[model samples]
Target: MWYYTLNGQQAGPVSQAELAQMLNGSLPSDTLVWKEGMADWLPAQDVDAFRNIEATPPSQTNGSNPYAAPNSIVDENIKLSGTDEIPATPIPLDIGFCISKSWKTTIACFGAIFLTWFVYILITSIVGGVLSTIGTAIDGPVAVAPITEGMTQQAPFLPSHNQSINQQTGTGAIIAGILNNIFTMFLGLGLTLIGLNLLRGKDTNLGQLFGQSGTKLFRLIGASILYGLMVGLGLVFFIVPGIYLGMRFMFYQTVIVDKDLGVIDSLKYSSSLTRDNKWRLFFLFIINCFIVLAGALALIVGLIWALPVAWLTLLVAYLYLHDGERSLAA
Candidate 1:
């Protein structure tokens, strides 16, 4: 039996032949592999079973591997990535399968995910604090007049001195909140993209989270806002329409982050990709909500595990939907 590690998790117990076939020209030379005869796990290239298979070079053309055996496990629809040595073959994934994979990936990459969110919160807090302080300085102190016992200060919105100060503070807080929300939205785009990578068994670091591609950040943000507005407007008409729109446009961010597409194009692509699977996606979303709620009920500690799992599950689903759409089109 052979076992392989992906995204820092052990993923198989297949025969040597299947493992070799699955991995030959499909993974990097340095990817870890192990079997019963081995003392410990080693890189695929170092193992005798895989010595005959050469690692696919980065410069290889965007076509099927010539060296692959007749019954190689590589899928015909697999597309070559210029950045990755081995092409990633997207397979149609079921909700249950993705949920399981998402949980595993989340657990494996917990430290990185937690640190990324922590840094985001910390920076936003600092900015909000600075804004609050500046707002306070500008507003100056509020003067409170001495009142006899039982005399009620009934001026709620009459522009009293205290009311003025409170209003200014409220305005400042609102401004700071808006700024924080904007920053979080952009930061979250990058984090979401990092989570997407985790679904493919890639280990992501904090540096990558911050420096992640911003080539389509604004477009992503725009698409997100547009989707939200569409959903909101649909809800105004009725509940079912909103749910429908939500499911349909759910993958807008995924398309934007993965394809670096324009705002409108990402929305259209997401709509098309989700056309036949809206009900499945809707149920998936409901299940995930329950999963996260269950995690939150576990003294709030479970959210640390649950939230990442939910995010990764959606990414995995997006990958499948993306592949499914391509196949249908072809």
Candidate 2:
């Protein structure tokens, strides 16, 4: 049996094979490992049992270690020394595995997610209703005569009833649209915080999601706006550039929400985190799009299931990338 010091505390009594599995790829190569036969603890790679096992450099992107058993790999919940942070470790993500994890997480957190959306909708509805009532009170009633059959047959070319409704609702619709975007921004931030905490294996609830996001609202907004502008500008110049930059900056929001970073710092951090993994991300994005589309095809009700699944998958990707980046830094 062998024991290892992970983060700081001693953990294990793991068998030689278990230790070898970890040393081969799971635990960092330089992790301190000790066994009964050793005089002192030494790095895993330096131990005789693991001397032949070459450590995979953190920067490697070949996806060679995809088949490692989860039980043998370092626990996803493992924290860094002196901190509660989950260290990033990039691993090959199977499409099915990603989908499955997303589905499970979405199911577990659905209640909180439902509450978050419900409140958002309620607030937006109240705001819109108030604006609508005020608009009606100021504008007075609008009356339109019903078109008779003979009149309709003679003037079939005229604008239809739907157009009338659209015309009457124009200002209110614009106001509602603005309100929806603003409210969605806040809702996104709150949900993001909730998801991040869950990913880090911390306990979080619906209330805490919104509560913690209050102080960070402006920062979130700034990061979102900056990311949008960059993507929009890239799109304006060229289609390819737009797609590339969009993928590159996709993690900006995740970084900002997770680390409370400023717009520029988050952008730079996400850019580096995603380096050499853009294609993987692209593949994941396409798969998610298809998954969502399939859900939408099912009478549009499946989006309830699909939306959360997509969100969870995205968080997994972010964590993996962030872990890899941290490992490289280490």
Most accurate candidate by TM-score: 1
Estimate TM-scores for all models: 0.62, 0.60
Clashing pairs in 2: 88-323, 88-324, 89-323
Runs in model 2 lying further than 4 Å from the true structure? 1-96, 118-176, 213-215, 324-330
Clashing pairs in 1: none
In Å, residue 267's CA in model 2 sits off its true spot by 1.7
Model 1 spans > 4 angstroms off: 1-93, 132-171, 212-215, 324-330
Candidate 1 local accuracy as lDDT? 0.66
The per-model lDDT (C-alpha) reads 0.66, 0.64
- Number of clashing pairs, model 2? 3
Index of the highest-lDDT prediction: 1
Task: State the lDDT of candidate 2 residue by residue for 15-70, as single tens digits.
Answer: 45566667777677766676544566777768777778765442322322222112
